[model samples]
Structure formats: C-alpha cells, structure tokens
Target: MDPKPSARVRSRTGRALLGAIALTALLAGCTATGTPSPSEVPHATTPSPTASDAPPASDELVAADADRPLEAIDAYALCRAQTYAFYPGDFALLEYAPFDEASVLLRGDGLWFVYIEVDDGNRPADLVESGASNCIVGGTIGEPKWELFGVVTRGEDVVDDYDAPLPSA
Candidate 1:
C-alpha cells in the first residue's frame, strides 16, 4: 500500500519540525560564544565554620606539651628584648648561639627546657651590655623558662651554674 504524495510530505514536515524544536531548546541553553547560559550555572554552596576557625579558649602555653617549639623560640626572643635590652637589628651580632645549640631540651622529669647558649665575643658583648643588663630571665614561669646560666667571653669565664627547673616537679 503506497501512501499519497501529500501524506508523505506532511509526515516528513512533522519530523523536521520536531527535530528543529529539539535543537533550538538545546542551543538556547548555551551562548553563541559557547559559554553556559545563566540558567545552566550550578548553585553555589557556602562552607560552614570548622574547628580551625575557632579561637583558642586559653592563650597560655603548657610546658609539658609537644607543640611548644615555636612558642619556646618566641619566648627566648622576647626574653632577650626585656631582660637583656637587645634590639632587633643589633641582637644578631651579640652572637647568641642558642639556636646553634639545641633550642629546646627535654628533661628526665618530663618537662621541656628552652635554653640558648650565648658566646658573646669581646666588642659585641660590650656593645650589648651597654644597652642594658646582660642577664636574661625568660618570660613565663609555669613551664620551662630560660635562665641565664652562663655568659662566656675571651680570657674570662663567668658562670651562674643553676640547675634547670622541671615542669612536673
């Protein structure tokens, strides 16, 4: 059974019209430049606050804690400023070799001692002492604090020789 010429023409026209409509809908979702249309953009998700975002409840540093290395270094630098009167730019020349030595020491008592050994050669040592007392007592007391035990110089030996304090004891 052969369809009429008019029926065949209508069937072809209907299929073409449906295909054109589908193509138009798809093309409408993208710009001529090929970027996604505004309607096709994904919704933005806002992130919630995490534990890292929260501030510390207490600002104090515990002596027995393992994470106090940076804090200990900071305390040493601060102690140099207050007790020794060493300024930032000039302090390096004083030849404080504390960092060259171990900056932190763990004692048998389970407490940490933050100490810096200073070898101040003659002229630099004189320049440092002129600013203030060469004695440096560390900042905080609860934990291991730096005590000025020895200040060595050329042709002269000076020593305080005090035992280090333990946080547990």
Candidate 2:
C-alpha cells in the first residue's frame, strides 16, 4: 500500500480542518467585544451557598474533651471515620462537593446532631450512629445516654431522612 493517504481521505481531512477553522472564526466574531454575552456565560445547574448565604457556624464550640458534659468532638471524629469506611474508594464522602466540613451541635436534650452536605443520593446514618455510639461508654442497660441524629443534604434538598435507629459500635 502507498504511504500517502488516499485522495478521498485527504479531501475529507481538509474539509474537517476548514470546518473547525470556520467554527473558531464564528465564535471569535461573536465575542468580538471581548466580553462574553449573558447567554455565553456558564450557569450553575445546582444551588450552592454563596458567602452571604453560608449557614451559621456550629451551635457550640466542639473540641476533644472540652468542658462539656458530652464529648462532642470525639463523636464527630468517629462519625467522619465511619462515613469514610461506609463509602470507600470512589464513593467516598470527600469525593462529593460541599462536604468540606460537618456542622455538629449538642442539643439540650442530650442529642448530638451532625449535618453533612453531600451530593451523593444515599444516606449513611447507620455509620454515623455506629461511630457516635462508641462515645457512650457506659449507660443504663447498655443504652446510650446521648443519641445522635444525622442529616444528609445536597444543595437545598434533603436526600436522607433522619429515621435511622441507633447502631452499636
């Protein structure tokens, strides 16, 4: 076979190159003013929290063994660990957006609330409860004095409900 491309193939390649050049020129002319049109600007398909719309900080300051009745920091750490274990590899929680940190709050009723932002559709409440339960070292009849409630969300939508039973670690 000849090393040179066939005439038919050469003609098709030349046409494709000319088509690309024409498209580039058309786009350049459309943006000749150097500023992109409103239609040309990319828009977000999902709602994200802007600087002013950011959620309030955690209800209480959480630190390991802080001067609090319950060790909230430990529970939060274990919850994150369990979350990582539940969703390993590509399905990990960190793989999703808006999951930079969790909002942890210890309510007056001795319930710990952990809110995590995740784009994934599934809720990992069992993992959270399992990790948090570890903090309940001793309680009446093996029942934990403090309970954990988890809320998983994506943008403004609540993907996971908080009806999960307490999981023993």
Candidate 1 lDDT over 1-169, as tens digits, reads: 6566564477668879999999898778787689996778657697766889854433222334434433445555544544444344545556554544424433444333334454334445455433222233433444334444223332212123223442352
Total backbone collisions, model 1: 0
Count clashing residue pairs per candidate: 0, 0
Residue range 52-144, candidate 2, lDDT tens digits: 885433322333224444355554554554455444345543432222355455544455545554443243654422221111211222233
Which candidate number has the best lDDT? 1
lDDT of 2: 0.45
Model 2: lDDT of residue 99: 24
Residue 17 of model 1, lDDT score: 100
Lowest lDDT block of 10, candidate 1:
154-163
